[model samples]
Target: MSQELPTRLLLIRHGESEVTVKQIIGGDQSCTGLSVLGRQQAEALGRRWAEGHEPKVDALWSSTLPRAYQTAELLAASLGDLKVQMHPDLVERRPGQADGVSFSEFTDQFEWTGDVHPYVPLAPGGESQSDFFHRTGKALYELVHSNPGTTMMVVCHGGVIDVAMRVLLGLAPAAPFLLWTLNTSITEFLTTDKIGVWRLVRYNDSSHLSGLPTHTDYE
Candidate 1:
């Protein structure tokens, strides 16, 4: 009998964005893409892969957001120029009316006294925590099943990666601890022979950015 090949998924968070610097809610409508440092971070990761520091990526995907798409583009320039496939479902949590609002303004408008409900949207018409988790979980499941036995690179947001971890590890929707995924960091997962079994190959790997300036924002 032959051993079944495991599916490999590499989740990479987009580099620091203008929204992080400006402290604004960056939905698809307000995202202006990567900042100067952000571009450099993405370039650093690209160079790492170009130098054979990571495995060869069989496929490339990114969220529809500009920041994610731009990061994927930068990586592709070094990763055999792989065409990046955009997926709306892989985007960060939808901010809705808070798309361009600053953090201060958001707090002034909607103040939460205690732990917000999972079903309550952070912003008007936005996706609740539960909704975002479900969307990302479903998208990740589809991605893994659609391309079995292949290594895929997905450029998205930190929140999406967090949801991916929970979904793969069978954790609760409400995260007990923060992942703090760094900008342009890589989180890898591999599927096992048993159904719904996944192994965490690595998390928050940004070795290429050892000397590069990076941000600590939670976006």
Candidate 2:
């Protein structure tokens, strides 16, 4: 059974976005491009992979967002012959009308009533916590089941990684937890069928980002 074999996942956060630099609340639907620094980060990560840091993977997947897709493209370029499969379901949490809004404006109208209904949208036209969580979780589950005993790389967003952490750790769906996945950082997970559990091997590894000026702010 595919589940019986160990499935390795290289869960990566996409490079920084222009929205982060401009202090906007751009989310999934946002088509914001990557910052110059973000491009460099993506290239650096690709160089790291080219240097034999990564093993041949069964597949490379990325979110449909411009930032994520761009990162995947750059990384794939460095890893000759690799192609990326873009998945819309893997996109970051959609902020809907909040997309492209200034940070101050988003906060001014923000409401936190998720405790009442996790399925309720975070904002007008935005996805609910439950919706985001389930979608990301389901995508990851499918990735694991479909690949089985192979390695896969996924370029996505911080929010998606957050949801993955919660799902794999058996944490409460909407439990509050602080997490920060650096731009182009790698988070590893291993799944085994015997226990049908996912084990986190590592989190937020950005050794490739060494000597690079850090951007402390991003969505």
Candidate 3:
């Protein structure tokens, strides 16, 4: 009999960093640590997942960003730390010179007119949408294909998650920005040998933010 693959990944995006709260640009450069509320969000997710899920995870993976790293640490603690792995492929898109700008500034500088309201155009020296998609596919290929356990958790950014879905769903590589990932939200997809038949398990599961004063809302 063929062995059953793992229960799919519990993919999560890190909590809102200070950059998110401030509405500042945080791409690959100049990281923005999580805000106080973001830390709380991380705690909230950890509590819920630890208390709610039945079987524990076989591994915990996170991007190298400070916000993602911290979120992963908190989650690892709650999950009892079967193992923690850091993967550089999971890093956010490098916005290059636009990393420290405000949203208004970003639009004013770059004439972005996509149907997707918040899709940022790559400023000079920054990564284009296609390039970002390429990087995202690379990340998922490593994470999803490399692991075959019953379950695993990978904490990453919203952009990475968006591109990953597009790739897994066999949609065009670029254009769409996000799959509704709120601050500290979760997005799940199940894969099989059949390829392109992945299951869309969940998206933006943020019930833990019902009462938080500083909760963030993403499109």
Candidate 4:
């Protein structure tokens, strides 16, 4: 008998969105759809995947946000119309009262002290960095256990990817970790036989965006 392959996860950040372009603070309330460039990036990602850039996945999952949903739809077009399952748990961290505020105002009001203390929330009624960690961890853990031994693709926000990395590597939620995942970028991981262990295969891969103008906004 042959040993079964470990579960493979392809984590993709959603394409550019109106909120990201306009420099607005969405906190999870930013439902604005993808911009024109965002659409092109999504299509390019699809072409890349269809051209053997990524393995055929058994399931597709996406955050409930409109930007992520639209991205998943566009990418699915190139992957044989892969059905996408929406997961609210995969959505970005909420900024609560700061949801629709301007970026400057949001930053002025909320202290980004997570690097010093991970339990700090962005604002009153918002989720703390620690809260984000457990939520993303639970969601990914369940996603993998439910779909054991298969490739899964999850389209979500950049912050979610950040949390996912921490969750997979058992890092402290509020640690000073900084990295950028470009629009429609790919981050790959694999579940190991050692229970609750995961291996990172790649991070922030945007080769599909080559020769294309890239978005320089948040994640």
Each candidate's TM vs. the true structure? 0.94, 0.89, 0.85, 0.90
Please provide the root mean square deviation of candidate 3 (C-alpha atoms, Å).
Answer: 3.6
Ranking by TM-score: 1, 4, 2, 3
True-structure lDDT of candidate 3:
0.75
* Comparing 3 and 4 on lDDT, the stronger one: 4
Worst 10 residues of 2 by lDDT: 107-116
Per-residue accuracy of model 1 over 1-219 as CA lDDT, tens digit each = 112766889999999898888889999789999988899999999998999868889899999999999999999978899999999999999988889999878887777454778898888889999999999899999988878878899999999999998999888888687879999999999875547588899999988889876564544
**Candidate 4 on 65-147: residue-level lDDT in tens?**
89999999998877778898999889888777878777777767675543434676777887876787788779988898788
What C-alpha lDDT do the candidate models reach, one value each?
A: 0.89, 0.84, 0.75, 0.83
Local accuracy of candidate 3 as per-residue lDDT tens digits, 1-219:
113664477778898787876777887676767878888999999888778563467788888988898899888878886456888878888788888888778887776454332244377677766677787788787666667544778888988888777776777764534366787787777665434356778888888777887555532
- Model 4 bad stretches (over 4 Å): 1-3, 109-117, 192-196, 216-219
Give the number of the best model, judged by lDDT.
1
Ranked by lDDT, top first: 1, 2, 4, 3
Report backbone clashes per prediction: 0, 0, 0, 0
Model 3 ranges off by over 4 Å: 52-55, 110-121, 175-178, 192-196, 214-219
Task: Tell me how far candidate 2 lies from the true structure as C-alpha RMSD in angstroms.
Answer: 2.7
- For candidate 2, the per-residue lDDT at 28 reads 62
